[model samples]
Target: MDEIFHVAQTRLYCRGIYNEWNPMITTPPGLYFLAVLFGFCGYERYLNSLILPFCFAGLCRLRRFILISTKGKLKKEIDQFRDVRLSALAICFLPVLLNNSFLYYTDLLSLTAFIWGISFNSSLISSIFLALAVLTRQTNIVWPALNCLAISLNLLKQFLFNQISFKQLFFKTFKFIYQFLLVFAFMCFLVWNNGSIVLGDKTAHKPAIHLPQLFYFVGFTAASSMPLFISYFFQNYKKIFNRFSLISMLFISLFAFLSVNCCTLAHPYLLADNRHFTFYLWQRFFQRHWIAKYLAIPFYTFSAIFMFKMTSEIPNKLKAFYLVFTSLCLIPAFLLEFRYFIIPFALWRLSLDYQSRKAQFFEILINLMVSSFVLYLFLNRPFKWPSDPERWQRFMW
Candidate 1:
């Protein structure tokens, strides 16, 4: 369904009809612009496949940036070169990300732009990528804005603590603001677009304060990176369980129950679309029984707590900014789509301080298996819709 609009728009661009627009397509035209650069390509899917290399390049750059950022804290056992390469490969094959890579969707290109924006050291170049990111997807504006805020907050703390002179702080802040101008540009675009983030599909993509999205996102990170979570659990199981008293456990349960009971939202698209895996997940688990939603609370709690524990090794400044940015990104969306969780999950997965070789190997193996499974289902398991019997509907993430 989404491919219909994206592929058509790119074809129009290929024909030199740059003015054409699709009202059903909610994202900006950056993806189409990038697709046009391939000179119409061998096929639309092939053109989309070209974006994967750029994505991998950006991921490698991001891994290098992470290694440099955590160099002092890195374990002596960590093999920097091999670990970086494998980690980038593992992330490139993440189920949701890899599934979207072959489609004419904004997800891969948007993520690539965002990753380069974060990884690049040059302010002008970084801002260019960041602006391109927002041009690909309007919601991406929040990330650069959050990045700017994080830098400012960190600098302010350093200045306050007398660790950095006011002169140095002023120069650093200026450099950050200059590099992350995407946020400012995006705000200007929003005003020009009549205060709407999405260019089309305004009715369907309505903004709401759906708080349960945070829970769903956390659960997704936990599930997607289960190998690391399991490793963390075994290494710190005693410390983890010790933090949870009976009363704390009860409080967590009550909080999860209320969140599920009061904050859960069923979007119209989520209910109507069976071609996407989220629909089945909703129908099978969240809607299967009255207590099914409540049952998910424990998993959510476990994810949130353990994820926090895993990130405890990051610097205080970065950790605070990461949490703030993640919450702001996920808290407003009213949908349960897994694609929305991809960027935040990628950042979380990359920034972890303890990704041993064993964890990386398991991560790659599991992601490969899941990616192959989903690809098989998408290709071979086609079902016909009664309303459109001529069209084959395949399952996807």
Candidate 2:
């Protein structure tokens, strides 16, 4: 308890103007204010540090309510509370509760920023949180960028495809550009105020560029681009693909890949151990190891085959072509690495919404269950049970 108190106190004092050089204890100014309030009680300091951001995120949602009310747009049928609760549950509870609650990490902040951005549609607030997320941990950079790109693409779609009138397209483009400028300006302000951009202590000494890191980054890019290539090939061969759908798939695939990669790469210890390859392998195997993972491939292949079972929806010729393409492209890929194949499979499944909800639900359930089971087995057992016997026993107990 005393040690915890000392640590909290040290963090508080380190935030003082007099201790500007201490990089280890630095936190965002927003978090620092909360730290000052609860610093006397160490645990409270940490708790409050976590709670305040969540509170601010709540306030951000509330601001949206206030906006709607002021505009006299709040309707009885709106059920603002239900909407808020659902959003909170999905954005906050789903990821944090299932994945990494109590971690006090940037992921929470990233999610909050994401939710806040969606809630208010205020680029400034969203960009501020995103910038803080990156400053707190560089891994968070991808999500914000991806989100912005998603919004940007959606706007582009509206301007180019949806809007029939030139005037309407011009107006929408201007609105998007204005919002984007606000976000960009906010980010610039944050970077300027933060003095030195430090990812972490490990990165503080080294220059940003490294050759091996670049190579791995290139590999990740290639992996992400694979879906685009597949989509394009299908389109060229008079298959099911179209430009809009292809772009959307590429965006999502690249976004997910980048988000996962950035989060993984920011840790020096992970980089040191070449955990990238291990993570790649895990994803390749759908989070399983050698034999079990290999066995799962046949099941996955069967599932992919089932995807084509909805052939009644497609023209016979196109269906035949798609089946042949699926066999040649998806089967070989699934056999080699089911995890990598799963993304494309999912994209294709989602594309088939006109098929049937029941079918989609079953496909999704199977994918989730298989993937989760494999992950559980990998994380729990790996090569040997009780890799750390003490930790394993404690976990069980």
Candidate 3:
């Protein structure tokens, strides 16, 4: 609310187009517009309640899409839709989604647009929803990127089968990306206007690698999602070192560098106080070589294994794209927050089997418990939990 009120009072595109309290114009105007709408309704909280129903509505549409996509592959036609839809709902209620829905955050808005984008069959509709998603949260460009890759691959397949010509595929690709040009232009405009795309006063947000935090993210994210695919990882150990995994390895290595340079992070609570530790590890550690080798590499490699095994059930063509997409979402951030892992976990959890009621039930229960812990952290966590930031930076993650 602090940032919202600060931005709300200002006329956009006016003279001195930056808020000293929360400058940089990092976030596009979507969330601010929604905040102003709810502010008029005069509610202190529970505004997410109004948006919650729409999120569920998006899930319903997404569930139908999932079922339709998985059709005839499953054995029984009669029970397939029910089971698939249940699994979709199960994923939808995971603590991350539940928690985000209660807060006045952009996660739900971006998620709604994302789910609806994937649900729609038309390229135009999908592009619009994805464009809105990017507007809501700048990092959401990955959604459109993944979509463009999928469409291009499909067009290639069509051309190979003689269903479409080379010229036709080229034009289609151009048109698809062009439809999203407005959204991209708006992002460029924000960066152009902000003068420094880095949010807030530059002094408040230093950049650092902090490989230890990346280690924490991979381990926590993997455990939170569960070990359902651990066996497959071992069984296909040799085959797992494919092109996609190689690319993923290089991507993680690249992430460490980009994050250190402040190139990869997006809206780490841009409008809020810069309370988060950015160059935290550098402030304390003289050396973190042990961490990069033993911690960062192992956790990141295992995450790739888990990602490969979990995504095996999905069609092969898009598997590599989703793996890259998932990695792109989490790795750029300065903070190692639980909320950062939600997007990847939510999408992968959809593949869980609803037939095993006990398994599904337990999964939801575990996630809910984690959600409870996160809620506790949000509500009651002490500011002095690690009062000495520089001294305790290693343990911060």
- In candidate 1, what are the lDDT values of residues 256-295, reduced to their tens digit? 7777788889999899989989999999988999888888
Candidate 2 lDDT, 218-327, residue by residue in tens: 23322322333333334444443456545645554454444334422233432322212343444555345434333433333323233443222444554454334333
TM-score of 3: 0.65
For residue 27, give model 1's deviation from the true position in Å. Answer: 0.3
* Candidate number that wins on lDDT, 2 or 3: 3
- Better model by TM-score: candidate 1 vs candidate 3: 1
In model 1, what is the error at residue 41, expressed in angstroms?
4.7
Candidate 3 residues lying further than 4 Å off, grouped into runs, are 1-21, 37-41, 71-86, 149-178, 182-187, 190-217, 227-303, 351-355, 377-397
Residue pairs in clash, model 1:
none
The collision pairs in model 3 are none
Candidates ranked, most accurate by lDDT first: 1, 3, 2
What are the runs in model 1 whose C-alpha is more than 4 Å off?
Answer: 73-82, 150-174, 244-255
Instruction: Write down the TM-score of every candidate.
Output: 0.89, 0.38, 0.65
Q: Tell me the TM-score of model 1.
A: 0.89
